[model samples]
Target: MTDLNQAIETLSHHEEGVFPRKALETLLDNQEAVNPQLLDYLESVAIDPTGTIESWQTDFLVVALFLLAQFRDVRAYQPLIKLLNKLDSETDWILGEEGLSRILASVCDGDVTPLQALAENPEIAEYIRSEAFYALLTLVCRGQWDKSALHDYCRRMLEGGLNYEGGYLRISLTHICEMMMFSDLLETIRNCYQKWPEMSEFIRFDEVEESLQSGEADEFGLSFHRDYITDAIADLEKHACFVAGDGAEGDDLDGFDLSELFGSPDDVASEVEGFFANAETQETFVRDLPKVGRNDPCPCGSGKKFKKCCGK
Candidate 1:
């Protein structure tokens, strides 16, 4: 067996030397038999600063935790909450946002008390603060908190300057708008947006009207429009750049156009329409979109598949 396989075998009791996918399937099938093992594995990894654990091991742990939550195993709450808090402190050491998000999705349904506690902590890290904001918005969207409470909480947090970092603050503000929209707290949302014009890109009136007409506000409510607007604004900002001028370092080139390189606007529109017109094309487009794959080269450009490189 390979050395990694041997290592997995030494750590786990399964016959195979590899972290078995069947283990996860089995755990999901029978929560009682696998929860203890899953909990032990999660605790070990939570304290593992060196990150010697394999990617499959982490994946299995996360899956098992999610299953635990799905099964309504209240015992999983404390450990999951503790991990969320520590993940903020050790963002670099952990498996990054994907792992954190998976954990959040698992435990978010049980009890939001942990999130509230984290928000109230004086030593909250920037990562934790951002996550708490996200969690609160999620709770609001899920109808766990009433509209008035959610609005007041978001307002208090923002006014308190808990999310003072530029990027974190911007994201928090965007999420606040999302929560307000979900709860139909439009007056409050508009107040906050008016107070911060920089947040205009994060809110969209057209999509809100569309959602209202379609009666599709049941899930994310009108906030889906705000997210779309923010995404479009972000895309525009990403492509905005200044090119070098004659002798000077550079000149601000606002309203620069690159339609020639991309053909006509009609051509661009057709390509986009074609992408959405066929299932195969849509699937291909989605697959090509930036994503992390276990078999693809590590994003760090380590020249190795994620499972065998940094993710290892």
Candidate 2:
């Protein structure tokens, strides 16, 4: 066998971690000696019909491809694209999902055609939704595409929120919005909040608040916060309406005893007054407490430290 063929055989037979690491290092060091052999191996791995490639192998291949792409090796493009398509075809393989995401990100450096193809594939749409959403988000953020497309896509996805089979997708949409800094997407989330009020409480308003405070605002800016908060309040109002309709059946008043529920007016007033009095006392005690930091003196007045004391 030729020297290059021997190197390829040695790489294939070695364990994944060490072999890929060494082979990649060698390829980077001696490109002329190993480039053809490396390309051939990638093609074989990309077309492996048995689906026997392990997660480590997939990770190595993806990393190798990413490195090649970074070098602007035009020869790597077709093979990487083929691997991406193959990964998209194998939805049952979780490793493929990760590999495809990495590959898409790597190739997205220049040509977006592969991503567009993946986005347009119906069979892989659901499986590839998050990656596609993110890629489009990157495009919008980088001014590569018109914002209208992203807005329309987000709107369509949110419109189907009620029927979504995966909660992760819903959460991912929120993440994508945050990443893209697209405040317009807030309206879509608002529609979702209107449909499901309980979900309103779970929304991370603090992140939005922080984003706004940091001046990292993107398209639509602070309007995102205003719309989101307004929608949450509307959902809360709807919740109140439902409670009113449920009347005595509502759990809002269900946890009390008979006496608490329908007691003498004076007795109820006294109990309420006592409850508030104790609650106020507890609140005062808490409010009067000294703040402790890791470097601060202990509340016990110990000279050692807070973290070293009761704070521990």
Candidate 3:
């Protein structure tokens, strides 16, 4: 058995990928039963840190939570739930909410009250709420809930439709319709054109009918178009909200095309080092690398096509 003491000690450097995956895999592979020590370690990592210094710990924690689920033990559920409670659309923890949804999809088992609570909470960020909304939708669509109850749930989802910032909600709605198939909600979505008459200019059904007549129609094509209309209705304006600006040194190369100088990343790094060591060689360092055709034999002489070998 792998030493549990060493595994727990290595988590202080959880920002590195190898330790978490190895530690969790060891815990999962060895014991037939759930270990309280392992569970405690998962809980500590899963908790969102208040300081930015350990911000990347959230990513490590998410990986741990997912590894916990592979064992199918219910003990992992509560720690995963606590991660869901920390979802913030504005936060840098990209996987915290998304990872929770993925883990819950398999383990919730008809108990989606926690998901519903997060979805209904107005205080949560809109993006996180939309994620929770889709997670609940996924459960309802897959679970063996009563037909009437399912219908009610779908109605509530459409009625409480999301505002289309970042276009995430529309994407979620499209997925829900495609997965759930034809239902009462399809009719409800069709009637949305009448209720929001202004959106009619943005959405049209003529092409959908034409495609159906021409045998070119796709499943849920109408739902896909409706999602587009939802985005159009929002009259999206460019916002710097999610746009990541380049670093200070990179900002000076605004109109420059940097792709002309190319080589393998390692070769480029070596050239950069050489240039730093002797500034006079800068001009000669940038040169084109010989290109290899995809179908040609690999230069490595392993007797395989380049595309099928290292080119991949």
Candidate 4:
């Protein structure tokens, strides 16, 4: 327990016990020393995630990411982005939706360009890319970025054109508009629906219109703003991801049954995992995003080639 590697090992190698709070405490006390090691560990994992996936029984990676983010360590940003870029869906099974949100939001390094890339890159997984959209909100909420700039950026992204394959990105942007209360973007959002009619699976035009009609953003809090160690510890204190010494696993679904967090492996276009605050509203976002084949007639039925119509 004298070093971070040992602490990481302790957290990683445990079997049938409570979360190893002691090891985490040791690393937190030695944050300055552990940060270098933490960055290395993150970079190594980001470079080659095989080790993490192969030895996936423990909560160690969770500990590593939470620790790095707790300190807002800029060194970890690129590695974290790389990890997500190179990440397979199996790895996301471990991070879960909320976990992904926390990590992406804090690791932005005050420059959202990387996050913008992640959000815009259709090659990356949808859930991962979608989280980046919300991470912008987190930055704005924390007062680190200008909401107006974000609004303009989002408008440009909207104007850039959204194809069928990346329809979910438009929906994610729609969610952002609601959060920021961008009434001016209402027409832009409507245009998105016009282009990608399938967006109704997650949100209806009237719903967005009604939400905007209220003219207020809902209270939102996704990232921690208090003491890092205390909040990070609080996050896992009764969590079910790890087996603690006391053997008190919390009531939430265990990590083993986490397929719902991403989607059924058989389905490529995954369903939604709730990251929203209201239960009813969260349900509105949950659906297995339907895919539109390239050659098939466009759903919008503009009487043109599918590609010429609402194309990806």
Candidate 5:
């Protein structure tokens, strides 16, 4: 067999943690030298009919796709896009889509119509749709497309409320506002805050508020709900149970009968008060117990250092 064929066979069967990425990278960089072999291997991996590619092989396959995108040739575009279309919402496929996004953005060619269709397709899973939206937005930010068109899309996107769904309770529309260098959409988002108070978490209200308070911005900014103290007080009141009269001295409230357990109210009150007062002092003594260094001998009679015996 030729040397390139030998390299492909060697790479596909490489053991775990023994990836041939550097060699593959060299071949990908020199596309003219190894295009035939590299593309053949990519097609074989991408069209695995049995769906039985081993985990390690799957990792290498995605890396191969990523390297093809880095080649920045139109030839890699259609294959990557087709692979994206065939992918499902499975975790593995989601990861593959992420790799596809990099390829899509690099070879965007100033035409985002395909990406926009995917972004607006409600039939597709949000994971993939969000990736498309991000890729589209990335093109606009990179000056690959006209700003006015993307701005209009951003406005329309905000009109229906951001469709972002992921961790951290935030979305990318706020980031788009910064990237587009316009605050009109931001104002619209803030205006919606009165009706939807949760929008504050997604937008960085703290930074804006600080900026406004410092006279860094002209407007007073939107009203943010900083009612943490009020919420905390409400929680305390909910948990507070106020007995009508003295517990031990009067008829036992809540039927607990504290007198039976301890004694009369006077004795119980004195003991409890004294216990609280002395508790702090006793706690200090307990906390002041000599610190046992990790390397010091264990105090449990193990005859070993603290780290070796108890710390472990």
Candidate 6:
């Protein structure tokens, strides 16, 4: 039986792309012992991001995150939420917005009060702030939160409860309503378009009507956590980037996409590094759009197609 610290150490410093499968399994097998230690380590890194990230040669941050997420320990909630608040949006490129949101949902253990507050907080980076909603929506879809309660909470959001600047919180809340098919809030939603004409530019008022009337879940909404499973080892090794030896970050198939997660391709860093690097750099407003046509004008007002712009 390897100690948790030993297991973590074994997983670290893999410049040669050597994954210690045995060490990771030790963690997975002893989640009750490992989860809190993982959170503590994450908090330590978060407390001194630059120093720690610069010091880390091992991908312990990524390992800890996936483990904590799958364990679904409520204890993991505050530390991850605190990091979400501290990291801001630039990390969006690092973890992929959906990826981070999945972690948030996984760790919340069905308690969404923190997520609601984060989603409604105007001062938080929109990318990070909006993640709370996506995570909450996932929990709702998973039946962790009552659909009626979610419906009511979304109604409150649309009815000026989200009354934050940047208009993103409101837009995000509306998307939640669409996902939940909360048709009861249609009039309230219509009022939003009238109150803020620019809202239509992000999502057409007509599409909202169509989606709500469909009597089915939006495909995008249905697809949130399909890959965020509970088996931590499988979660790690399923991705070739996380594998080691020749299968790891050698010549080709290389580490995961840095543009989607970290560095710049040749570099195989994880979102944990980027999240610790900066707390504010502005998340593009276009990130709030849902299932927008690639051919549509980029919502950021750049006039480029969505595919060519932020959607890319």
Model number with the top TM-score: 4
lDDT of each candidate versus the true structure: 0.46, 0.48, 0.46, 0.66, 0.48, 0.66
The TM-score that candidate 4 achieves is 0.68
lDDT per residue, candidate 5, 176-264, as tens digits?
Answer: 44444546565655554544555444344554334324533222111111011112112212211111222335454685655667877
Worst 10 residues of 3 by lDDT: 228-237
| Rank list by TM-score | 4, 6, 5, 3, 1, 2
The residue-by-residue lDDT of candidate 6 on 102-145, one tens digit each, is 67888887888888877776665676766677777778767788
TM-score (all chains, Cα) for each model: 0.48, 0.48, 0.51, 0.68, 0.53, 0.65
Clashing residue pairs, candidate 3?
Answer: none
**lDDT accuracy of residue 163 in candidate 6:** 48
Q: What digit string (tens of lDDT, one per residue) describes model 2 on residues 191-263?
A: 6655654333324444444553464544442121121111212222222211223234455656656774577
Regions of model 2 farther than 4 Å from truth: 1-22, 32-39, 49-60, 74-82, 85-102, 120-122, 125-127, 138-164, 193-312
Query: Candidate 1 vs candidate 6: which has greater lDDT?
Result: 6
Clashes of 6: 2
Q: Superposing every Cα of model 4 onto the true structure, what RMSD results?
A: 13.7
Model with the higher TM-score, candidate 2 or 4: 4
Candidate 6 ranges beyond 4 A from true positions: 1-23, 30-33, 50-58, 90-96, 195-202, 225-229, 233-312
Question: What are the runs in model 5 whose C-alpha is more than 4 Å off?
Answer: 1-3, 10-21, 36-57, 91-100, 161-170, 191-312
Quote the positional error of residue 312 for candidate 4 in Å.
33
